[model samples]
Target: MHALVVDSDAAESSFLSAELQRHGFDAQECVTGAEALEIHDKFDLLLLDLRLPDIDGLEVCRAVRATSDIPLIAFAAGDHGLDRVLCLQAGADDCLAKPYGLRELIARIEAVLRRSGPARTAPRPATDPLARGSLCIDPLTREVRLNGRLVHLTRKEFDLLHRLAADPHTVHSRARLMTDLWGYPAGYVPDARASRTIDTHVSALRAKLGAPDWVLTVRGVGFRFGRA
Candidate 1:
């Protein structure tokens, strides 16, 4: 895999590039945000640092996202919560705080790439709606119907439900859900805040569906689509 490393710090960039190369990535290094934008299409993924010479990294993230859905990881030094959220909101696929371990960085990279990569198993066709008993979800139209009645949900709520219903038997952890839905890596957001966010959304979803058991909580674990 080819990865573009965007950082103004020479030593940091060199370390990241070398490490990525050791892990089988063809790493390309660029020192400025402008350079990154100019060569973004040449790589399979992006490793961006928030501090840059010409333009801010968040701007770079927005620019790249406006054009392509390339896998992006923002590695920056700042308050973990705020920086992580900002990076995600700006369109990065993952955000890692500075002074992060190389192993963790690699793991995050692999995880993001895995999610962005094509599925290994054949997925349900996009045009086909997903149905489980009284619940129905149309991915193409982003529509959900419960018991033959239309249900209104925000984007995040719809996405959360779709993920759970997609794998009804799997137990999704709160951390996993946060990463999948919010783009923040597991543990990046405080446990309490993340759990609350998920719970609030689940509650809204349950109320809208008028079926409290539609989504079952795994207690301390996470949530799943219950069998009707």
Candidate 2:
């Protein structure tokens, strides 16, 4: 399942998004109402912040409701009773206040999804092995074969590689990579040494596979699967 998190606060949006990703959702961040309104149809659900820099969140709700019935969970800055009511009236499935616990958020999300129906369960992964050049990844077997021979990889290395390779060329931020590679919770900014964890894994993977081109460093961003 994919989630679109729309919030003006960069830290808050990224935190929620990364938290959602940890809960088995491919979460994307949108910082403006216009961007949310434009690309929202691509997601299974929307976590909309009522305070947007561009357009009013209520108007966005109306616009989305006019065309689509995607599940929406409105986020208020505080315990604003009127805002929550307006959100529900404007087609939001549910409304939540900020500083919400992950369990509550997940519960609300599941409840909304249940009421929406059809997408009650997340989609399953593809069965076919992902092949890129002479490198092949098999998720089911948790194996990686290079040039017809199996290449030994640590659990974390395999996971990191497969994650990047899953979406070739898509940049995964260092924070996101650390969160996924380790079990860092949302809002937990990694230390300089801890952030280097991914770099070490990437280095080891390159040494093992003898293919440094397989994963490309994105400088200040993160790593992406190269088109090797």
Candidate 3:
């Protein structure tokens, strides 16, 4: 496993790097945001310090998010509520306040890595076709693959994909998806928050697949499942 540690403090960066190496990770250290950005694609995971010499870590997170959905954890020395929230909203998968224990950090890293780890090797294709372009979905195994490459997805995410892929080219309104997937009647509740939940799951699913273009948003309607 590979990781990128972006902490300006030499001592802190060294300590993190050493600990990661001890745990069997090939860790790289970058002291500035610019350097981190330049080396982003090469690293599997990022240990981003919220404060950098060139820019705030939130900006860096946003920049990284624009191109990739690589797992990211924000580490900081100071307490900044807004920054922490912004980091998550901007695209970070996790956050850690500094003065943190190495053991805890290691645990968090392991957990995140495990969650993002690759799925088992390709399985035999099922009878149904739940797919978009090169991506294929299997409800039996609760898995989706792009060109035979497994794309990891959470339970809710897999369900959402299954719904869409089960009927490709068919547009399903958000209300319909929420009612069908979440088992909530549309008119039962006035708020209809379940509909919005579909949006979040779709966004996350797209990000996980590294392509938001697959799920087309039909203006004033719902989403259509198909490759553009």
Candidate 4:
């Protein structure tokens, strides 16, 4: 995979580029968001720093997302919740706080790529709609309905729900879900982040479906479809 690293800090850019290279990615470095925008089409993923010389990384992310769904991971010095949320809201697939470990960065990159890769690009299989109680999911149409009413869901949200609903009796571990949903190996993603990601999606799914009990949480274990 090829990655575009946009950061003005020479040392940080070099470090990120080298790490990406070591992980079998062809790394390209750019000091400004403008440069990143201009050449983003050439790369598979973008490693964007929030602080850029020309344009803010968030703007760059929005601009790129307007035309492309290419995977993007934003890096910033602040590790605050709002910072992370803003990055995600601005079209970033993931966010990394500065001083992050290289392993974590690599894991995030791979995870984002897996979601946007060719594996997910193929046409979905034509299967009969899955019905459990009032919820229904049509795999072929990628549509979900709750109590016969259409329910809108993000791509990741639907994928997560489908995975659990596909095997309602099995309680899927967060680590396992992380691997299946985001392609992050068990040890590659931090436990807290992985849990948060799953929890957030589950919460969104429950809210959208208006059926809180549709997806049951197994406390410290993980989550499963159906009632407790």
Best by the lDDT measure: 1
lDDT of each: 0.82, 0.80, 0.75, 0.79
Separately for all candidates shown, the number of backbone clashes (residues 3 or more apart, or on different chains) is 0, 0, 0, 0
lDDT of candidate 1 at residue 128, scale 0 to 100:
73
Worst 10 residues of 4 by lDDT: 117-126
Model 4 clashing residue pairs (backbone) = none
Can you give the TM-score per candidate against the true fold?
Answer: 0.55, 0.52, 0.61, 0.55
Mark the regions of model 3 whose C-alpha exceeds 4 Å error after superposition: 118-214, 218-224
Candidates 1 and 4: which is better by lDDT?
1
- Candidate 3 differs from the real structure by a C-alpha RMSD in angstroms, to one decimal, of 7.8
RMSD of each: 9.1, 17.4, 7.8, 8.1
Over 4 Å off, model 2: 118-228
Write down the worst ten-residue block by lDDT for model 1. Answer: 117-126
Model 3 global lDDT (CA atoms, 0 to 1) = 0.75
Q: Is candidate 1 or 3 superior in TM-score?
A: 3
lDDT of 2 at 13: 91
Which candidate wins on TM-score? 3
Residues 99-149 of candidate 1 have per-residue lDDT tens digits of 899999999998887766434442443567898997899989989987888
In model 3, pairs of residues that clash are none
Cα distance off (Å), candidate 2, residue 196:
53
Model 4: residues >4 Å from true position, as ranges? Answer: 1-70, 75-111, 115-126, 186-190
Per-residue CA lDDT of model 4 for 1-228, tens digit only, reads 888899999998998899888889899999998889899987788889999878978899888865555688999786788888888877788998887988888887777777653243333444888887778889889999878889887666888788788788999887767766665644544465456556777887888777788889998778899652
